[model samples]
Target: MAYRLLALDIDDTLLKSNHRLTKETKEAVEYVKNKGVYITLATGRSFISARKVAKSLKLSDPYLITHNGSFLASHVKEPVFERRIGAETVYQVVDILENYHCHFKLFHEKYVIANKTRQKAQLISRVNLQLTDPLFYPVHYVESPSHRLIDQPLSVLNIRAEFWNKRERRDALEELEESVTGIRITPGGKEELFINHESASKALALQNLASRLGIAPYEIVAVGADMRDRDMVSQAGLGVAMGDAPEEVKASADWITRSNDQSGVAYMVKEVFRKQLRIETPHQ
Candidate 1:
């Protein structure tokens, strides 16, 4: 089947370990996009955080599946679809997290509100640079985010927390799961966890976007490198997993491309999409 849409995860799937988009990857994306295949980013990142990558890809007006599907929007202020964590649930989560030593941030479309401790601790400094890019995604650091939220009451898409210790991360996950309702906690690893609405997932968001575009499920290609991407990859007509992806994620994929460092996205696009397109085009 000819795939019409390509959904890509941002972190490990698209960007290399250094968090930079290679020239080859960009060109491959351009090649496929020029073939009338729609390309969109399906990332756990907020809209603002994902903007730099979108800008690099020259996606002038592309649909963004952000916050792990909690939000689907073309522009920052104009949202086609969105699901915000209820105010009460947000406060409850903040209160619970405050008891721990982990650093957390509340995700929003325009900006991120994070605990000041993250800045002080200099956690994930490289990633912080991306998250705090003033032109794209500005970060607001506060001493007590829960109190600040009570006063300001902003719409939160999701919450992401980073832990320095593996045990602490596990404990935090357990505590949050036992105490929270109407929230889903996705343990990214021993260092971090993502909290969003239970209904939110990249697969669901992709489905919603595809339906709106009149693209059938079998006409979609999804690529990712993390377990969180499992559902999205499996549901796509042509599911691709990064070579370095977890075994389970690879098992769910229809194909496995090279690792990110080897420019897997470029390989997949050129080898699969471009080559296939060429095969289908008759010599005239």
Candidate 2:
């Protein structure tokens, strides 16, 4: 079936090795855009980070699924949907991380609050490449009235933990699930834990966007490389996994393309558009 919408993940799927778009990829996207296909970006990064890529591609003011689906905004920067973790849940999670002596960073909109620890600040700095001044609010040195100090509608409650110890993380997540109503806990990277609402994810955001555009689930194509992206790949009409993706991720994909550094996305777009053009041509 011809895909009407193409949803691509950033990180290791769309961006190249150095996290930049290649000329070939840019040209391919432009070609597809002229073909009248709706191209959208689905990513774990926030809307701010995703916008750089969208602007580079010159996408048609399409919808964007950012923060793994916690936030959805249009190319014009208009918020179409958002799912925030409850304040209570955010407080409890902060407490839990503190009790376990695990470093973490809290994201409240564009403001990222991290303890004075260099480790936590470094993590935030890496993800938010442009964060020159990360407001260092020392968690340990805070004054009295700690309860009132908790932030509101935390976007991402990130915890730094041993990712290899799956059992420990799983137990923590299971416990968190019991306490929070609209929150979902998932693994982030190799040694980190990310918490967001159950309603937040690329799949949910795409579904919402599809509904708004009057497109069906099977009319879209999704591609990604992370475990968090499993649901999205499963739901898309044609789920593609990056060549460098883990075996588990590749297994879930309908097809495996080249690595991001090899211009995999550009190749996929070229093939899809070529086939589309062939279909429009008269039979021999």
Q: Write the per-residue lDDT of candidate 2 for residues 1-284, one digit (tens) a residue.
A: 76777788988888876667788988987776666667889887656567777888886456788777877877324688888776666677766555433445565446455443334455444555522233431223222212434533443422233333456567666766776566677776655687777677789899998888777888788889888788898888888888888787888888888899999988887665676642221110
Separately for all candidates shown, the number of backbone clashes (residues 3 or more apart, or on different chains) is 0, 0
State model 1's lDDT.
0.84
Worst 10 residues of 2 by lDDT: 137-146
Best-matching candidate per TM-score: 1
lDDT of each: 0.84, 0.68
Question: Across residues 163-235, which tens digit of lDDT does each residue of candidate 1 receive?
Answer: 8788888888888899889988877754889888888889999999999888889989999998789999999
Lowest summed-lDDT stretch of 10 residues in model 1? 275-284
RMSD values for the candidates in order, in angstroms, are 3.4, 5.4
